[model samples]
Target: MTSTADIGLGTAELTKIFTTATRIKVCDEKFRSLILTGQVSAQYYSPRGQEIVSASMGAALRESDYMVTTYRGLHDQLAKGVPLRELWAEFFGRATGTCKGKGGPMHITHPASGLMVTTGIVGSGLPIANGLALASQLQGTDRVTVVNFGDGATNIGAFHEACNLAALWKLPVVFLCHNNRYAEHTSFEDGTSVDRVADRAAAYKMRGVRVDGNDPVAMHTAAREAVARARAGEGPTLLEAMTFRFFGHQMSDQNEYMKPGELESERANDPVLRFRAALIEQRVLTEPEIEAIEAQAKSDVKDAFEFAEASPLPELSELLTDVYEEV
Candidate 1:
């Protein structure tokens, strides 16, 4: 067992994680703005506070590994090296999108880049990840598949069926549940009686671990171990990241159910800000360095917005294409 003192978190890497989280925050804001302005036609769900989980996990992944994410998955795509402009174009329903404009915001996919596909249906990607893992196993490759979903997904019947199948086959898959406190406006407790989604792993007889989703260091360590185990012929693992989503479930939500001071307290633990402060205190990066990184990220995001606005929409003839292979 690796000792807590021996955890390899240098100052430089921690600072990078912090800035990445900040970039995610900015992305969410921009996505929401585009939706409100009628530039985008979908409901925008911002993973505002839970950015650390996706960023840390994405960083830990090898280039060849595959990842399947949910509709609220901008962070995962960004982490997986998908260009911001392309993602923005997808949201804008332009030709330059990862899916050539038809996939839209929720249905992002980049198979060549190791992202199998992102689905809008809650809990639907779990079995797809299992299939990917099975394919990798048969091909004798060490490619692990990671599926990311929210707390709402955990309550669905598909979640149970997928977990059972993955464990039964001993597939090399990691099921990551972002327990973001609420499923839309419904609290987790109200949605389900389970205290921790990871607890359900017991039914599948798989290894289960819960980590503080806000802490990038913790997430990185957990993902590293889990991915390593999967590659080393171990079966699946269920990782529940206890996190909070700062924004409403969608752009249309008024978030009136959130109690007084709840959001304020959650904002106090903003992962990006907290991680930045930790990096500075640990002598990893200076304030000036942090500011420089933020400036660059903002500029890149701005450029992406411009690119999306200028890009043309998908051609009319292409609509029926990519749906099925040519005979």
Candidate 2:
């Protein structure tokens, strides 16, 4: 794996992104608790150590720009400035949810907040993002459409078709691929031949890059560049962020497939910790500042959970009615 040392982001900013990583950890711990306690039945993929890529990507976007996220989309939404109360409500299937309790955990839509919609299908969001970009391009708008997917998604037909059309039309889209080395227990080496997902960008004749997904500053800088290029009508860009998932593919997976010591190894190199270390090393932030950020994130998340627990589920009368419009 390539180190983040070569990426084009400032150490101080990268530290901010990484050091402020407790939100993701809080999410992970809460997710596990949810699963263990049977609060949620669906599968959960915790991007424990891979928070930098999604969070930084979200941080780089403008309010007008749109986003299409994947199943593992909580981080993306939170990073994009979605309110904790709304996010928790959505996860809890409450009327206050971004999708009004229709989309659940895997499906979240906050159009007003620029989150178009999140799909349950792995690579399905790519084509939707392409369409969004096409709409923007045809209408002569400068708004950029960004899409997020996992390493496993690259091999899917939806991903291929979306990229092909986006490149053909010179759409303003940035395809962010989070290569976490595994596609639900299946390692990348077992799945395909390509050493790096970014290398596949060459086949489309579009700009392709491989960056350390754990480095938030690097991700932010890269996303800025890609968005800039897209807005300038230079065409789409493919960014493959090399990251690692600290948890099993989903909540149910035994994760026996994970090599021994992998968890320990990744923990040592965690983006959040490393980023914090970098900040202190550079004298940009002190220990108290880092602790304050973490404490706030935790307090915020705790409040969200409490709100979600208190929020009522959708009523039966409304559920049967929202499926179709009477008019």
Candidate 3:
């Protein structure tokens, strides 16, 4: 991650973005606790090292802009302003969740926030984002659609197809590839053909760039340009943001596939901690103020869990509802 001092952002805006990033980081930590402590029976994809990507992107986005993400989208969800209580309820399988507890962690959808869809299928989000962009274009709105997915999803056929169509139609969309270098235990070299995922953008005739995903400044700059291009009717931009995940693909992953000392090395350069330190160094915030943010994040998480605990589970009556429909 790079320093925020050179990012040209105001102190107030810089702290706000970093604060949300920190809050999301803490939320994921608490969630890992829930999974390991057996408080919840569900699968979760941790965004430990990659919070900066979503954090910067979220900060750059508007409420009216659309976002489509894959199953491993909890970080993206929280970054897009999904309420803690609603997200926690979704994880806890309560009726008050974004999808009324049925979507669990994978299929959460909240149109009110413009988080249009969270698909379990890899690479599918690209086309969905394109459709949202199309809607915005037809309606003559400058709203840009941001789609986030893993590096592995880029190998899927839908990825190429969507990119091609987006470029062809000049759709207002940005493709943010969360390249953690691992696609469910497989290395990028083993799965992807190109050395850099950004290189593939040329095939679709779209602007592409690679950035240090763990760096707030870099990620924000890349996302800002991409959003601006999309909003100006210049078409989509593929941002291949590179970073690593501290944990394995899922909670149950034993991480036997990782090389020794690899995880330690990555964790040493923790993005959230780096950003906080940068903020302090820039005098944008003080240590005490940051600590207070951390304390509030903990309290917020606690309250969210409490609200989730008190919320109702999906009822039998709703089992058949939001499922098959009758005209």
**Candidate 3 wrong stretches, greater than 4 Å:** 1-5
Order the numbered candidates by lDDT, best leading.
Answer: 3, 1, 2
lDDT of 2 by residue, 1-327 (tens): 124456545545555465336687787688678879987665566778778887778766787898999888877777766677888888878887877787787887887778888887889999999989989988988999999999889999988888888888899999999898889778888886798888888888888999888866677878889989999999999999888887777777777887788867987888877777766666667889878888888888889888877888888787776678778
* Candidate 3 lDDT, 1-327, residue by residue in tens: 455556687776677678788888888898899889988888788888988999889988998889999878877887888888998999888999988999888888998888889998888999899889999999999999999999999999999999999999999999999999999989899998899999999998999899988888888888899999999999899999999998899988977888898888999989889888888887878999999999999999999989999999999889978887789
Best first by TM-score, ranked: 3, 1, 2
Q: Kindly state the number of residue pairs that clash in model 2.
A: 0
Error of 1 at 314 (Å): 1.1
Consecutive 10-residue window with the lowest summed lDDT within model 3: 1-10
Q: Kindly indicate the candidate among 1 and 3 with the higher TM-score.
A: 3
Q: Pick the candidate with the highest lDDT.
A: 3
The parts of candidate 2 lying over 4 Å away from their true place are 1-20, 39-42, 325-327
Top-TM-score structure, candidate number: 3
Better of 1 and 3 by lDDT: 3
lDDT of 1 by residue, 279-320 (tens): 667667788988898888888899999999899999999998
Question: Residue 113 deviation, candidate 2, in Å?
Answer: 1.5
Model 1 ranges off by over 4 Å: 1-6, 37-39
